[model samples]
Target: MNCYECVQQGRSEVAVAVCYVCGAAVCVDHVRAESKLLRGPASPGKVIRDWPARQLTCPVCRAAEESP
Candidate 1:
């Protein structure tokens, strides 16, 4: 599929990733990599300190999540 961000700029590049939050198709250039600490189904503090984590995000979601 075409990239959501590239389409906005009148370009059409192949989508390399999908935004986890918005499900928007994005190309490598539009993709934002982030580290997300995940919690397991086990009791709160019982989970591993560095369990499965991190994911790709889109520009829009990244901006909304950025610190002020």
Candidate 2:
């Protein structure tokens, strides 16, 4: 698939990943990676915090998220 952002700018760059939030295809230049901690069940009363997982999003979604 081609990058949504690149298409807007009249470029046809190959998409590397899809945005996790809005499902927009994005290339390396348009992809935003955000690390988030994942919580999982460990024991009966304990929760484990795993390593931060990467979440990809388009620039539009990222900007809206940061705004409010």
Best-fitting candidate, measured by lDDT? 2
lDDT of each: 0.88, 0.92
Number of colliding residue pairs in model 1:
0
- Give a tens-digit lDDT track for model 1, residues 1-68: 99999999999899999999999999999998877787656676684455767699999999988958
Model 2 stretches astray by more than 4 angstroms: none
* Candidate 1 ranges with C-alpha deviation above 4 Å: 43-49
lDDT of 1 at 18: 97
Cα lDDT tens digits, model 2, 1-68, are 99999999999999999999899999999998888988776897776768778899999999999995
TM-score each candidate: 0.80, 0.85
* Pairs of residues at least 3 apart in sequence or in different chains that clash in candidate 1: none
